[model samples]
Target: MFFRKTVPVALLAASVFAISTPMALAAGKGEMFMGQFTTEHGTTSHPMGDVHARLNPTTHELTYSIHWSGLTGDVNAAHFHGPAAADQEAGVLVPIDGPYTSPLKGKVQLDSQQAAELEAGQVYVNLHTQAYPNGEARAQLIKH
Candidate 1:
């Protein structure tokens, strides 16, 4: 009787583990990426800004929040520029449409290539202002 019960319980536990392992693997873990914007990182001079973002690997969804103060002038645009290093420049990969105000928050769906670049730490955030059309502040997004 002891042997019979032990064998069945062990088999049940093994079955459950096998079933759940794939589900957990498929769900994956959420990845975090963050950056701090500074005039030193950009082509022109301006005040500081910050960005925090999360990427859901399973869904390919990216959610972000940004805050800034003391810019040279009003912000006109912002973007995630990528496939480049912190010291390098690249065309915009994702444009941040906005009322151009502070404490910006939004979400976007990233393609596989964009997601891969972001995970590889080749992406950066940029905020553009009237005083600095190229970009007022910039920061490289580092994965955490």
Candidate 2:
């Protein structure tokens, strides 16, 4: 009877400890923030498919990935729009992968400050193709 009671208690304690461990760990336990957007040229409505950004918690460095099949015309510029929500106005936060042509690929590197915004969920990713030339896709960065 004594052995049975002690074993059960020990197991319960171990289980509780395991459950709490992930939350307490901060170094390698950072999260990924993600979002996406897309647009075509000469159209007020920008809706293609979506784009994504995978960000590292500790470094703030980011890898931007975009794929909006519906985007057309051409792109002019792409940037990080900030401090706002979708359809809620626009703010300049940082820059995306860039110096784009067309038939774009989905990858770019962000600097330190841009990475900081990414961790804070304040930054957004924008893409411009030769067709749109202004901005064809956009996605906000948020902890995922």
Which ten-residue region of model 2 has the weakest summed lDDT?
99-108
Model 2 agreement with the true structure over 1-144: per-residue lDDT tens digits: 999999999999999999878757753554566665644234565556444556665565555555554556545566777665555446566555554544344544566766665667776666666655556676666777
Which candidate leads the pack in TM-score?
A: 1
Error at 22, model 1, angstroms:
9.8
Alpha-carbon shift of residue 27 in model 2 (angstroms): 11
For candidate 1, report its TM-score. 0.77
Q: RMSD of model 2, in Å?
A: 6.1
Give each model's whole-structure lDDT: 0.86, 0.60
Superposed model 1: Cα runs more than 4 Å off: 1-28, 40-46
Error of 2 at 51 (Å): 2.4
Give one digit per residue, the lDDT tens place, for model 1 in 80-117: 89899988899999998798788999988889999999
